[model samples]
Target: MLGAGSLRQQWPPAGKLHGATARGAGRGEPVVDRELSIERPDGSRIDVLLNITPLRDHAGGIAGAVNIVQDITARKRVEDELRASEQRFRTLANTVPVLIWQNDEDARNVFVNQYYLDFTGKTFEDVMGVRWHELVHPDDAPAYIADYMDAVRTRRPWRNLDRLLRRDGQWRWFDNYAQPLFAPDGSYAGHVGASLDITDAVLAEQALKETDRRKDEFLAVLAHELRNPLAPISNAVHLLRHPDGRRRADRLVEMLGRQVRQMIKLVDDLLEISRITRDKIELHRQPLLLADIVHGAVETSRPLIDQQHHHLEVRLPEEPLTLNADSVRLTQVLANLLNNAAKYTDQGGTIDLEARRDGTEVEIAVRDNGIGIPAGNLPAVFDMFTQAHRAAGRGQGGLGIGLAMVRSLVQMHGGTVEAKSAGAGSGSEFVVRLPLAEPPDEAHDGTAAGAGAAPLAGQRILVVDDNQDAADTLAMLLDADGAQARAVYDGPSALAALPALRPHTVLLDLGMPDMDGLEVARRIRADPAWSGVRIVALTGWGQESDRERTRGAGFDFHLTKPVDLTVLHAWLGTRH
Candidate 1:
């Protein structure tokens, strides 16, 4: 819009415009479409395209120059804006935590963000154009490619769980998802996708499934174990009722006792495992000689070894060793190992029990020439309710908690236990390592020192229970031991008989219909006359909390049933 004089003023004095125009006029040639910048009168600059041409006079000589200019400021501004927008998008895509990628219409990767590069540990050149799928695990690559191709062909969203190989050469699980992109014309474009690491979540889910499977298997095993003893117990009872039963009473009684003991053992194992898992089992630790403990364990496992007809050998170190541990629990640990060895071994197989001092710790090993554990199962041999030998049909009617109990009990004593095998049929060995203790000034070396104590002759004892059979049998047992023991069915009767009986000791059951043992204990404790009487809780509830409750109710002792006769007798000896 400016005049020629204003345009001429705007052109720089040293610029090429004047020379270019003169050259074009002299040669009769045209110079066209040269880009240049021009300033207006207000000092604002505009981008412009300039064209110059020559003008000729009538004699065909150069005369002057003609010039034209076109403004392109708006187009330049649009291009700048587009570049800035793309820069912003790249910044955001790279800064995000997840992998971000873009592909062209041909399904080739055109761009991948910083996160994707860092995750793959590869340069942009290495990951583009059909090379990205190589990072997927070999086992999962085929399926991943198939799914991606299907999504591309159908122009649909894609989702899959697969393993991807990391830069560290480890395969990890990834949950990949993608959404297909399209142009404004609705034509297909490649997809943008993200992958999330799901390895931990996947492992946790697998562990939960494995635990559920084991639980189901444990329940089935429990039913079978419980029924095995019941069948013989039932047959023994039936034979005892027959007319000719008296002739075979001793044998039938022995069978009945063995079956009853087996059932009791199963129940005890169940309760012990529950208590251990709940962190309720308490250890009564005391200094004891290793030899005494080994003797006790051998005594406990003798019946099983004899029944299996297995040859047993025992070895001990020459130097004396002691442990500050729970005697009963420690004994039970070794006994379980011995029983396991006996049960797994063929009849007349050789079993070895060895103990040695290893530095500040004592190592006890129980080994057998039996069907050894499979190599694959050694790690989980001590897992709860796991019977690695069950499939081989040598489980020997157990609920599969013995080894678990051994490990937990050992660990509770600040120790460790391990199972070793040279694969199945190569024999097996279980080693337990426990911290040693200095010999105490006075150590209890005897296993059953109080077991042969003086009888409760003339000792007045009272038994109270809701189960009539339990009460009667217990009272009979006490009377047979030379105590004047009487049975009462309930708390009320027990309270009524207390005045006349004036017993020295009362074996009370915590659970009764009309009045529970706690109230009775409270009442008995309140009366000064009964203060001298020793009250003991003879009930099925034996958790630490249960013991605490009994103590609060003023009972002298808590005993779980069916109680060990030696323990019961020891308590009675105190009253005597």
Candidate 2:
């Protein structure tokens, strides 16, 4: 089998092998010459394996050997594919963002991706097969281990848990999940897990709950504070008009009416603040005379100004200033400003109410010479329930909701209100500036406006209230108007005397305890005998919804307390 020439060529080439082949070739053993791929002159590749065996006569000895050649291209291609597959797996494990890890049933980490290593700032030597507990929060580690053991015993897939520290010394909230790996025979092999961060979500949920709790507490206190005066005020109006009461019951009725009106105003201001905060103000705008609305407000506040001994000076322009506004709401704004001036002023103080035009704007100012506002509280004066601190010393009786309403209503009119004062005890001034209206070409005159009529002249009427002086004074005022009148103490007695008295109309108070006005109206309406009777709701609950509710409950009309006897007489005239 020896081919001298070929053996010489192959033996020399194969002798160049390194490692085991080089040593073997140094010995007298056979040298297996394997050919790898080689590029030919035509640019094509061919693989060939050449084998050279030692030639000997009897004993093995070095000699010229025959060479055998075989093509091995297919086997080389298979080896190349195995190397590529191994590289792809390493690329995926190192580049993926997820923390990919594997652990045994004992919760010892066996394999980890490079990302997991980077996240924990650990080296393979420091982390491989390390117990997972060492990386968990000390407080949470025991519970996590107990849960993991339970899951393993039941052969369940791992789920979420909030774990803590990593090797980086940072506490993190992670959602840890793992899947059990099993062999073909269903035997446990290991587990793989991933940890995702969710700390923001947990904190946000807690924040929302805390906010809701505070809102509930605020509402509860507001309701209790608002309702304390309603019952007694209603009952006082009932008691003041007793049949056998003091001779000056009429005067007491006036005083009680003023107090009731004050309460209604307070409640209305609170509700308005609520509505404004919720952006629920719906305006009913129309062309109205600002002068007329302001005049009416001034007249309504005259009683309070008189009681406070404040000198009221009103200066209105001779010409009427007409603008597009909600008449009722505009009146409310003026009333609030006037009330504030009277409330804050000292006895015998002077208040100047003036309306003047400045080009496209009209400014209404209520200036008072009284206890002025301080510099610090001026900015927050329009904030709900924000009151100025007493200047060194002053009285506190108000709930501080009026100016807040004044500002809100003024803004709703597309206007602004500003409070100015030199300093405390130097007096304060509030200016309301609103956009002026374009003049109507057709001129209108207010010369035909009727003169003020006498208080109220009508048929005899009954005045019922629990307070003696209020009832008698109200009766006297009615009597002074050439109208016969009587006063009664309570709702039950008033109802008891209705047949004999045969009153034309009934003024019902809503907040009475033993017999509320709502119940009284219900009872009166229920009786077919009094089908023609008129029941007017007169109470301190002046909210719009409250008015609507009373109207729905069979009241002929809903009027707020501190009734204008002239308006009441007009209503009675129409009813009778």
lDDT, candidates in the order shown: 0.85, 0.73
Expressed as tens digits, the lDDT of each residue in 299-340 for candidate 2 is 878888999999999898887887767677788888878878
Tens digits of per-residue lDDT for model 1, 26-141: 45364444667789899999987777554556875546546667788998889889999999989988988767887665667888999888888899898788547787888889
Candidate 2: segments with Cα more than 4 A from true spot: 1-262, 270-281, 316-320, 389-399, 421-423, 441-576
TM-score of each: 0.68, 0.39
Alpha-carbon error at 522 in model 1, in Å? 17
Name the candidate that leads on lDDT: 1
